[model samples]
Target: MRENRLWSFLYKLQDKQQKWLWLRSCYFGLKTTGPLLLLGILLQGLTLSFFQPHGFFYVIYRLDRQVWVPQANFIIHSLSCIVFGMTLLLLCTAVAWYRARLFSKKETIPSMVIALFLLFLFNFHTKRMPSARLGQVILNGNIPFIEVLFLGLVSAYFYHGLNKFLHFKSLWSIAGATVSLGIVLRGFKHLFNVGFFASLSGPLFAEISSLLGDDQTQLGTIIVREVGRNLLVWLGFVSPEQILVAHTDSDLSRANLSAALIKNNLEGLPHPLNIYSLSDSFAVLGGYGQIMALLLLFILFSRYRKRRRNAWQNFLPVFLNLNSSFLVGVPVFFNVILLIPFLIVPTVSILLAAGAIKLNLIPPAVYQVPLNTPTILNAFMGTNGNWDALLFTLIVLLVSMLLYYPFFKVTETTLYRIQKGTE
Candidate 1:
């Protein structure tokens, strides 16, 4: 009788837990409804403003000239965008609040008043003229674009949803979100777009980074750009000819390709960006952020026997610098503990090297490098047989090692614990 009663008690407890989990998931899902719809509208505006997808997230070539709707001025567009945004907020928030029981009558009235005030402000601003700031924001990226912010925020919320979904043991919604992200999200007939992660990863430290200007070499800029860059690639944002132009013209990748014809002369017409060696400075040991160092460390020192063993076996492939094994083994993407450091290390390393070049402490790399050349060698070759560039990469490599160490250590322990069920 006692054993039977015990089983009965446990069953009731499990049922209660299941209910609680689903209830919480529903609440969170409802809360996200407004933001998700707002994000969709913002995405539409960005696509309209900058680049258009050729049916279902196809090749995203640069626009020769931005297209505006027929007979629409910036003011008209801005007003329409604002009006549509308000409609979304009203529709989404009302449904969400009703479902989630998120607001009291007392709070709802004030919230409605605040929403009305925004409507008035947007209308007032419409008459005042849409400032050139809108265009400026897109060009120089001086301010956070809603497109980028939306991606980062949605990724975070997706993770939040995943946690709740897992707690509730809801296979249905989990499959739905994942499948939808890849296929139905953009309505692309293809099964997946590589840019799916854009809305699912990156930009957790946005506020911290924003305080630092969105400079090319700033951590704040790198995190958003790192994720945004991949998304752009997945969206096929750059054409081969455009990439060629950018490589030859961009201060980052441009080398004196004519160095051989010019008798290795690296002098150039005066330009602020043209002065520094960028291609190799940005390329660390194996990949961006010099993650290979961490992989090496893991192979060498990981206490988890199985992980270290796998790393040891894969050393040569990783050394040859194949990207696949280490990416999954270290599991760099979406690993929250490592994300901040992954974003910061490359920027810090580049800034350090850029400063050295600026101060004439090192020779600027001016040669075009082979794309697959190893980083340390690229450092040596790209700088016209200079050893200092190699040394600079080594120094930056060491610094990256330091930055990544503690995070890797913590992650290793957490993974081990999870594997062993010790926690």
Candidate 2:
């Protein structure tokens, strides 16, 4: 009877695995378009980087001498013109088809037509006029209220069309599409002179021109600034000032002096980071640590499969870095008896380290660094040449691992008990 029950459970688990595999396969096939779209976007980015023209009137005054020959500008402008022309043709075709009632199936084409017409009306009103007097009229905020209504209509139509194309069925998809459309329209308004389908100048366009200063490097500077800021923010770390204040309670006088020294050093240095070589330290540390973690996880799984041991299943959550998955699956969720240490150990370890650093038991970490370059390497690089930061990160990792051990054992015990009960 026990053997039969064991066989039944194994069969059910296999069935569940098969179901998951099928669903994953279907999702992969459906998202195949994602890769092609990403490739196209990458190509566009590379073309803009190497070839695009710099400055205002790049499109209007293609004959003018530029520092870089504005070849990219011409290409982008020509492509935009082609896109605009094709969109116009497609809308006209759709309208004609609708009038003839030739195809009743796809409502998407008509929806696209409405979107294009609305965008056209917006462009018509906002476009800059050739005459100086008419340009001043637009500058003086004489835009009609009807034009504002058309802009709203344009936004709504764009949202609809994007939703149809992307097949956005969920609320998250709708919100994301709406935000993306807003950003794209804003880019168009700033980059190109056409306003509301009309040839007109607006305050936004004027601001862009003034800020960019007719320099060839304007676009490059913009790209660098935006990308650099975003990359820093994506990591958990903030600016040096923010990190110092949050992690230290040193006297204002001493803290300010230390920060100033670090800042000056960073400004004086020309290299990416003045400390240890970034490529050597980060590549080895992060690469090795991640690989070790994966290898350990694989070993645990292999052992479990061979031994048919329930304790092996307890490692799943930790392998995924969730920790709570095994606990909840084995129903350790409600048991406060084991939960306290499980949560407190890791939390306490991190907090203790932070507190010690604040109290100067160890030197405060100085660098604003990315975590991808092994934690230690990131810290060392951030500190402008301090090897001590690397050592500190190593200590912290050790403490964190020690804190996690008790929780791991508790989870394993729970899984074993459940397995025994099933038997």
Candidate 3:
């Protein structure tokens, strides 16, 4: 009965309408830009797979004389930026127009113009405009999606507030208001990028290294720290490498590698539960949080054809360990139902892998694998072709799918209801 009540509460929360204009606008903006964001991510993934040195195609195919790859990469990247930049512009315009239309039809056009001009200033003054050459004004990978979402909603609210209260009519007044708001929000954007937790990455890495160095550090504590790192990535404040790749160069990793070489086996190493040995090997099946499991869920069970299509499109990229496609495409970034499984699956996978290692079922992954290695095979390759490690990874993936099933079902149901309502 209590479980049913909890489920009811969750569904109610999901179904509730946003009260604030900014919140509603943000959601609207995200929906409006969904296709564009997916396109950008697809191009970004293509660039990663085809052009990057450690990319899936590059490493796997061993292209000896790829003369065209760099040019193709440049074109793809530029196109991606154009798509995302336009998406940002459209998002801001959509929000401002929506808010202004709510006030008075007369205010909508001016509000959009103000919003666009302000965005121009925000980009130009911040040196993000013309990201490379020819005044392209693209939002590149450096600009996190969180910032894009924030700027869209906040800028729209700013213009809406002006329309609501100031009611400025003169051209000069509108331009002046835009410039002033742009300057202030640009500062805020800079500060938001340099987030509180982001600054702690250096110290956090040091602390985690110290903990790993301590022979008495328990496996449970390390798992907790790993979960914390995933939380940061989920929030889009920190890169997955900042925590998951924390101790790569440390003495612990080197010692483990050396020990593995000497013994020709992975068992009884000095460090059995480091981030790489556990998280990289097991937890990050498809780029942080075992995203492959979710992709599988989408392909097999999604009610919406769009969801299934995006899932199929995201499959190869995520399999190659480039998950930005799924991240913004399905937009798991700020999603509520998906967040639960996103965090839980990784935690459970890490625990299971750790348990397996402790019980001598499979040795910890000690060796470093190639960058483009399919995440499912990281453990197997690191353990020198251990079939057991490969089997264990499959087991973890299966478990993750099981963990993700309930949440994904809820997501599908919600999507169905929303689709019906819209139709």
Q: Pick the candidate with the highest TM-score.
A: 3
Q: How many Å off is the CA of 78 in candidate 2?
A: 27
Candidate 2 weakest ten by summed lDDT:
239-248
Q: What is the C-alpha RMSD of each candidate to the true structure, in Å?
A: 17.4, 18.5, 4.6
Write the number of the candidate with greater TM-score, choosing between 1 and 3: 3
Q: Considering lDDT, which of the candidate structures 2 and 3 is the better prediction for this target?
A: 3
lDDT of 2 by residue, 1-423 (tens): 995675455445433433443222222221222223222222333233334442212323553455655665566545533432333333233332332232233444443344444444334433355653332111111222122223433443454555556666665765566556646765676555435533365676566554533221222432333233223322211210111011112233234336547676432222222112221222112121111122233245333343223224433323222212122222222233234333343234334444544454444344433312223344465555565556765665455445444444444444455477679
User: lDDT for model 3, on a 0 to 1 scale?
Assistant: 0.71
**In model 1, where do residues sit more than 4 Å from their true spots?**
1-255, 258-276, 419-423
Candidate 3, residues 286-338: lDDT per residue as tens digits?
A: 87778999999889988778889988977876786767557656666556667
- Compute the lDDT for candidate 2: 0.35
Comparing 2 with 3 on TM-score, the higher-scoring candidate is: 3
lDDT of 1: 0.44
1-423 in candidate 1: lDDT tens per residue?
A: 995675455445433533453233322332333233333333333333333332111122333344652334345445434444443344323432332233233333323332233222222211335653332111111111222222223333443455445542355654455445534333432223454444355474454444422224333344455445433322323211111111333433342455433555444413213312443344345644466677777877788886677566545434433333344345453344566566667656666766776776666665654333445555566567787777877787788888887777767656565567654
Among these predictions, the greatest lDDT belongs to 3
Q: What is the Å distance of residue 392 in model 3 from its true position?
A: 1.4
In order, the Cα lDDT scores of the candidates are 0.44, 0.35, 0.71
